[model samples]
Target: MLRGFTPPYTPDGRSSLVPAPPWHYAGTVLSMACPTEPAAAARFLPQGFGRATGRIIAHVCEWQATTDGWELLDPVNAQYREFILLVEAERDGAAVNFCPMIWVDQDISLIRGWLQGWPKKLGQVWMTRSYGLDHPAAAPLRAGTRMGASLAVKDRRLAEAAVTLDGGEGQSLGFLAGPTYGLVGAPSIIGEPTAGALRLVLPGITGRVAGPMASGTAELRFFDAPRDELAALRPTGPAVAAIGNVAITVTGATDMGVVAG
Candidate 1:
């Protein structure tokens, strides 16, 4: 029998690309939310989902992560950067966020996302970082703090955002509060009659913590790439932005059944 959760299973399970979850992550996030064209939003939803809600939440984050014992012995796998877009949509009459695009800097992270149904690709992500110091270059979290972030694939810029913190309480961010949904599965081969295609609702992330936040006014931009469709969801209005620390844990996913034709 195979000894690990994924392939390359060995007697000790050390060669597996991903360690079995519960995965834990702590990070600083710069987020922007704005309204996208309603029709563009609708085009991204899976069949049977309800109408588009016309908004999108874009985030670029720096993360520290661990899977059980991996933090101490394997610290190299614990750090990564991410950029994700959550498009608002309705499902069965309730609000939910559908992640149509996401990018991460690590191969391990890319595989973890596939397991979770997130369509994650490999990309370069950059964001402003803060430190606790008295120097002008520290980028301290206070009134008038300015932050910027961006993502690129193959040296081509895909998105960019900038925000100026106002030192006010974080807005409720209701549009981003909805549960996130993703499509996970594989396609069947053309001539394989017994081949089965699989699709399931991604597992929910648990133990989420959004730390004390700072709100800001922001601008976001999306650029077209030769092979990417990211520009399709670009917003037409100004964005609301925020900076916050976050922690999340992923346990197991419940099967939500296959999509119908």
Candidate 2:
């Protein structure tokens, strides 16, 4: 049984042919999430992160209340605490295992090497036993419940999920990006109303995706040119709000769900 919480989702009937990736319900993943609007955060975002951050903060609140987990609390000055991003999915669908934090860059080739087949060292970043060859090594959006902690999240909300990018020529690209921000307070994974489509969502611009792609099944080809495949891609223009639906299914204590790419 899952010891934590469950994330919300709105169903979109647009289902895809691709199955969930192998890492979804397996090992650890190296995820990276950057703030898409660092400028806005500095100018308009809350003075602190954590619960004060808004909806996503609220979601964190709920997850902590219900789940049995630990957070890094400060004992000296009695300030500054850090915790992992907790998300829940269904016992079956996409509510089992969910790691909602991940942000990496192209220059950080070390992460890429770890994701492919697990290298000894890529660059400046070396892998620890916990991070090495771990299929689902998680790197959630570090949320700071304390005053000083939240101030550190200064960057783009760019994320690289655990999946490869390079493919041959058969797989098509079927994916979902966000509610614009992320899963709301209660973390609702919302999306379109059709078959072959599903999305999990958050406030401002965060969401989950499930669909097919001509690029190939994300499950089989996520390790090729992973740098290209895992880059955070959110759709804009006319279809930004209407068609981007998401659906999430949790497996267990491992992976949250698979994003169809």
RMSD of each: 2.4, 21.3
User: CA lDDT, every prediction?
Assistant: 0.82, 0.20
Predicted model with the maximum TM-score: 1
Q: Give candidate 2 regions above 4 Å deviation.
A: 1-84, 93-95, 103-148, 151-261
For model 1, the stretches where C-alpha displacement exceeds 4 angstroms are 172-176, 188-200
Clashes of each: 0, 80
Please write out the lDDT profile of model 1 over residues 110-193, one tens digit for every residue.
988888878899999999998867678888778888888999999899999878888887663532366777777766666874
lDDT of 2 by residue, 231-261 (tens): 2222111110011112332321222122231
Q: Worst ten-residue run, lDDT, model 1? A: 193-202
TM-score for all models, in order of appearance = 0.91, 0.17
Candidate 2 local Cα displacement, residue 6, angstroms: 35
lDDT score of model 2?
0.20
